[model samples]
Target chain A: MTINEIQDELIADFAFFDDWMAKYEYIIQLGKELPLIDAQYKKDEYLIKGCQSKVWLHADYRDGRVIFTADSDAIITKGLVGLMVRVLSNHSPQEIANSELYFVDQIGLKEHLSPTRANGLLSMIKQMKLYAITLQAKTT
Target chain B: MMEKTAVLEQFDVYGIRKDFPILTRTVNGKPLVYLDNGATTQKPLQVIDAIRHYYTELNSNVHRGVHHLSQLATDAFEVTRHQLKGFINAAHDHEIIITKGTTDSINLVASSFGSAFVKTGDEIIISAMEHHSNIVPWQLLCEDRGAVLRVVPINAAGELDMDAYRALLTDRTKLVAITYVSNSLGTVNPVREIIEAAHANGTPVLLDAAQAIQHIAIDVQALDVDFLAFSGHKMYGPTGVGVLYGKEKWLDAMPPYQGGGEMIKEVTFEKTTYNELPFKFEAGTPNIEAGISLAAAIGYIQDIGMDRIAAYEHGLLEYATARLLEIPGIRLIGTAANKSSVLSFLVDGAHPYDVGVILDKLGVAVRTGHHCTQPLMDWYGIPGTVRASIAMYNTREDIDTLAAGVQKAASMLV
Candidate 1:
């Protein structure tokens, strides 16, 4: 599916939860079953610095498509990262780079992205897009 | 949650809990058992009302205007200085200078003291377990001055090694800056002895009381400390406000922290004279509402009584330490002989962030991560620990809830 298509599914998935917290519960539900990053890929070089909790992201390309894998020390953040990977993974690098991530705001996760580095959601998204841009550059 | 315990019987915690409105609230559909007091405290109703009253009735810029409202505001603001003077038993009211918070307070002393005393090859002493607020300022000052910053080591239990501290103090030592209580470890340093030893060597000391102001009684005069700093928000007061208490001799000798409106006597094309003590360091308009409300916070503490607070908090600490230790695979950090209400611990093979997230899900708020004490965390050879710090309002029931939360989190995370 395209990034926007996956994002719509995400919004619908979270729509059942009434409160922001119920959305987190759904996120945790997603996290429990999401594909975790490989142990070898989780290292200092791959670790995102801004998160209060530790988050490691790894990306690779296959047939001009970007595949993402990630993990977090905190489950809530893990859930959020899992959601991002599901949405952005298995897509063309160009699509990942240019796609507007509207589902974050639509599902009410956008308001929760604090300016502080400790929140790390924005930083994770930025890292994913940066990976896409870098990969797209090489492919072109 | 209070039992028939003798020490707790004297303290009316339930009455004190009523003063804080946030205690009655819930987080994530469960009752909020706030254990993040070390980060910041919940404001009592009196402090909230004081800030409200400031906006509704007597809000005005202080020490600048001559109107009736301005005069009232100035007097009320000045009264808090006197309140802090009594709060910490400082020798004089002018010794208290209100600043933004503990970080700003420390920077004022560091910058001022650096200009006057610190220079190339001079040594400064600080402990290993200090908060980033205390460490970074001195590091910046030392880097700027070409001076060396020396650290006093901590033992296995996290107490400052006095022998090492004593050896570190030398004729070349300019200043000894140490925390009155460890924000990360909960180790209470013997400031009186540290001050005395520093003074014997003719070096001045500054005590970072950011963690101790609410839990223990501090006497700048009794301890004979050269300078002391603490934040208002940590002591049931508003944010963006803190007190920096310095002796008269030091304040006179040091240069001003910032050049601004209230800190100046007069400004000219060529030369500008600085304002007198207290006001000299207080350069900006200041957090007028926070300053004005701080007096109510002090009053609220006084009403509860510090002795009673110390006893009750000590008991709660003992109770919590015992309870948290009961969980299998738990390793308690900072097992100092002298400690306060902070409990920093980690479960085996589980990250602190995971534990904290689960505790948070259960409505038990805790702080996780290195707690801005990266060096201390490095000393333990871990990323961080889940920290549960207590204030006067935290009760036995809170501990029970926290224990259950940790048990659940531990089982899942592990």
Candidate 2:
């Protein structure tokens, strides 16, 4: 599925929740199901800065597509990381880089991505795009 | 015990809550349960009104100009210094130096006092439980002067190891800067004992009273502490204003922190002589509004009486500790015998930030993460703990709400 299709699916899924607690409960469940990153890549070199919680991200380029994996010490941040991975992973670098993630706001999780939140979701998005841009540069 | 209960009953926490307008507000559609007082307290209407009065009536540059507004502003600004001198019971009003805040005050002492006294091969003593504000300045001073920095270790209960601290205090010790109360742990240190131990070696001690000044009644003369620093915001005053109360001898001897208009006797091309005590440290056009407004905060506290305030907060702390302990998977950090109002804790196998976020959704505002005491966090071998620090306005109901929030968070996260 394309990034926009995945985001739309997420927004629709979140719309079913009646209250903030229900939405957060779903996110917390998603946090438990996040795809674990390679243990070797979980060092300071890959650690994203500016987060109150520690987050590590790694990218791999294969079959002319960029695959992304991430992890966070915080469950909520991990859940957000899971969403980012679902939307952006296994896509062409240009497609990934150009993707506009509006579903975050639609799903009532926009606050988690704010710079002031310090949860690293915004930084995670930036890091993912930077990876895509760099990988796209290598082919040219 | 009966007398204590009587004082707590007379305290009237709900009445005090009305004075703070922010207490009436809500967060996330629930009544705001503000437990982040250790970070910065909500200002009373008195303090807020004083700020409005300063701008509306006496908005003029202080310590200058031959106008009525200037005189009013100057008089108001100086009144805070006098109030602070009485509030902390400093030896002289001139000993109160208006600073940016506690961090700025600590940096002032570190820079000026370090330059005057600290030298190469000298040692400065600080404790493990100090906030980064109290720790970083001394580290910078030590780094600049080629001096060594020594730390007093804390026990598992987060209490300072007095035996270890005494052993660390040696002839090489140039200064001892420690916090009177731990912001993260809520451990009230034996500051009088700590001061006496340092004084035995003729070393001047600087007490970071940013946490203590609001909770405890401090008499600098009685404590015989050479330097005491605190911020106004923590005590229900406006931000950007703090007080540094130094002994007359030290204030007289130390070089000026910042060379500027008010801090200097006179400026010349050749050499500029510094001004007298308090003014020598206050360099620029000060935080005039906050300086004046701080007097209102003091008046608010004094009118209620510090003894009554302490008794009320102690009751809240006891009630909170008991309520929170009933929740399963709860681990209370800083289990010191004596503590102020801070309650730092963690749920089993749950991150502090996640718990904090959950609590926020429930309209319970708590401070999460290291509380700027990274070294202490490192010692604990945990990332951080969720800290709910109480203030005078907080009641038993607030504690119940917090306990419920924490229970909900733990059930969700753990």
Per-residue lDDT for B75-99 in model 2, tens only?
9999999999999898799999999
Model 1 per-residue lDDT tens digits across residues B254-326: 9998888989998998999999998999988899999999999999999889988999999999999989889
Clash pairs, candidate 1, are none
lDDT of 2 at B376: 98
Interface RMSD value for candidate 1, one decimal? 3.2
Question: Which candidate comes out best when scored by lDDT?
Answer: 2
- Number of the top-ranking candidate, with DockQ as the measure: 2
- lDDT against true structure, model 2: 0.92
- Model 2 lDDT, residue B117, Cα: 93
Model 1 misplacement above 4 A? A5-40, A73-76, A100-119, A134-140, B1-4
Tens-place lDDT per residue, model 2, A69-122, is 899989988988988899999999999889999999999888888777787778
TM-score of 2: 0.98
Q: Residue B215 deviation, candidate 2, in Å?
A: 0.6
Query: What is the C-alpha local distance difference test score of each model?
Result: 0.89, 0.92
